[model samples]
Target: MIDKRLRVVLAEDSVVLRDGMVELLGARGCEVVAATGTAPELLAAVAAHRPDVAVVDIRMPPTHTDEGIRAAVDIRARTPEVGILVFSQHVETVWASRLLADGTAGVGYLLKERVARTSEFVDALRRVADGGTALDPAVVTQLLRGGQRHKVDALTPREYEVLELMAQGHSNRSIATLFAVSERAVEKHVAAVFAKFGLRATDTDNRRVKAVLTYLAESGS
Candidate 1:
C-alpha cells in the first residue's frame, strides 16, 4: 500500500494525453502540481514546484526529438532529489542509456503504449518517487538482445528471467509475486546473478545497481 501522496510535474506535447495523465494521477492519489507541454516549461515547473517526481515525454515541442530526455538529464543534474520517469512511445536505446547513465535510483524509463494497466503505471511512478527503479520490460528486452551474450549465457534460464526482471527494476517481493515463488527463492536467484557477474561484497557497493550496470555494459548502449 502507498503511504503518502506523491507530487508530480507532467510534461507531454499532446494536450489530450497530458490532461489524461493529470486526471489519472489524481485518481491514483497523486497530486499533479504542474503540467506543461514543452521542455522549458517543464524545467521551470519542476523548479517552481519541486515535485516528488516528474513524468516527461521523450519528444516535445519544435524538434519533437530528445527534448524531454535532455530536460530529464538537466533535472537529474540540478535536483537529484526529484525522481524522473521518461514516458515515451519511442525507445531509443542511446537516449535511454543517457537517462540512466548516472544511476538507477529515482529513475525510470517506460514505453507509453506498454503501460496499458493503470495500476502498473501508478506502481512504477510510486516506485520511482520513493527512490526505486522502474524500467520498462521493452527496455530490458532491448538491452538483453543487444548486450553481450557470453556472461548472460552462463545464467540458467530461470536465473536469466530473474535478471531480466531485476534489470526492469522490480524488487524481490514483486518478482516473487510475478513468478509465484517464495521471496527466498527470488533472493537466491539474485545472489546467483551477482556471483556469476563476479561482483564483490562491499558495504559501500550497491549490488543491484552493479547488476544493472552489467546489463547496460553488455547492451553496449
Candidate 2:
C-alpha cells in the first residue's frame, strides 16, 4: 500500500520552475518541507527538514559537473531513509550509476523531458517515496552500456534479450510466452545468464532482477 502524502525537498536553480513544482506537488497532497539550489544547500535542506524524498536537478550554479549527484550521494549515505529523485537535461550515466549503486528502493534518475507531464512526475515521486526504483526508460537504455564487462559480452543474443525483458520486470513465464518458448526453457536461459554473469539466483525472483542489473552495469561498462 502507498504511504501518506510524502514529505519532499526539491533542488532546482530555476526560480519560476521551482515555485511551479512546489505548487504542483502541494496540490497532489505532498508536503514540500524545503527547497533550494546548489549542492551544499540541497544537502543542508535535507538535513534540516528530513524530508521523505528529495528531487534534485543535475545542473546548478558553479561547476555543475555532477554536483547534484554528489550531494544526493552524501544525503543517501547520511540519511538512507530519504528517497532521492535526480533529473537531468542530458544523459549522465556516471551520476546515474552512483545513485543506483546501492540497489536500494526509492531512487530515480529521470530525464527532464519526462517531467513535462505533471502526472508522470508525481508518479515518479510517489514511486520513490514508496521505496521503488523507477529509473527512466531512456536512462535505462543509455546506462546499459556501462554494465558491460570483460566476460559479459559472451552472453547469447537471446539470453541478452531475456535479461533486458527481465529488467523490465517480466517473469520467466511471461518472457517465455513472449518468445514462444516453454517456461522450462526460459528458466534454463535465465540460469545460463546468471552463470555467465557469475551471479547467484538463489532467491529465485531476486536473481532475475540482479542478473538484469548486472547486465546493464556490464554492458554500460
Candidate 3:
C-alpha cells in the first residue's frame, strides 16, 4: 500500500481506460487532480495541479504517436519535482532512453499489459513519486540485449549484478535483502559500479542515475 496519499494527473486517450484509471487511483487513495485526453491538456493539467505524479500514455490526439512521451519530457524539463510514470502499451526503448537522458529521479517506464496487478501498478507509481525508479523487466531486458558488452566488461560479475538490480530501481538496502548480504556490501558494489563508470559525487547530478544512464547508453538502448 502507498504510504502517503498522492495527487495524480492522468493522460490516456481512451475514455474507457482513462475513466477506469481515475477510479482505480481513487480506490488506491490517490487523488486524480486532472484527467486529460491530449498531450497539451495533460501538460496544462500538470502545470495547473502540480500533481505528485503524472501517469502518461505514449500516444494521443493529433498524430497519435509520441505526443505523450514528448509532453512527459517537457514536464521533466519544466517541473523536475513532479514524478512521471510512462504507462504505455508499447516498449519504445528509444523513447525510454530519451525520457531518462538526464537520469534525474522520479521517473518510471512500464508496459501496460504487463502490469497485471493493481497493487503492482500503484507500487510502481509510489516508487516513482518517491524519487525512485520502477523500470519494467522487459524494458531492462531490451536495454541489456542492445548494450555493447565491451562497455560493461570492467564490472565484475557481482558488480554487474548490482548494476542490473540498480537499473531495475532497487535501493542498496533492497539489493542487499535480495542477495542476503549486508547493506554495506551492497554499497561497496554500488560504489564500485560508479567508479567503473567514471561517475563521481556531485551536488548537481545523481551518480546512481548517471550509472544507469551509462548502462543504458552503453547497451545501445
**TM-score against native, each model:** 0.71, 0.69, 0.73
Rank order by TM-score, top first?
3, 1, 2
Q: Candidate 1: where is the Cα deviation over 4 Å?
A: 148-210, 213-221
Candidate 3, superposed: residue stretches over 4 Å from native:
148-210, 213-221
For candidate 2, lDDT tens digit of each residue in 46-151? Answer: 9999998999988887886788888888888899889999877877877676666556366877788766787788888887777766676567767656444555
The number of the candidate with the highest TM-score is 3
Per-prediction CA RMSD (Å):
7.1, 7.5, 6.2
Question: Which sections of candidate 2 miss by over 4 Å?
Answer: 1-3, 146-193, 196-221
Q: Rate the local accuracy (lDDT) of all candidates.
A: 0.84, 0.77, 0.84
Candidate 3 global lDDT:
0.84
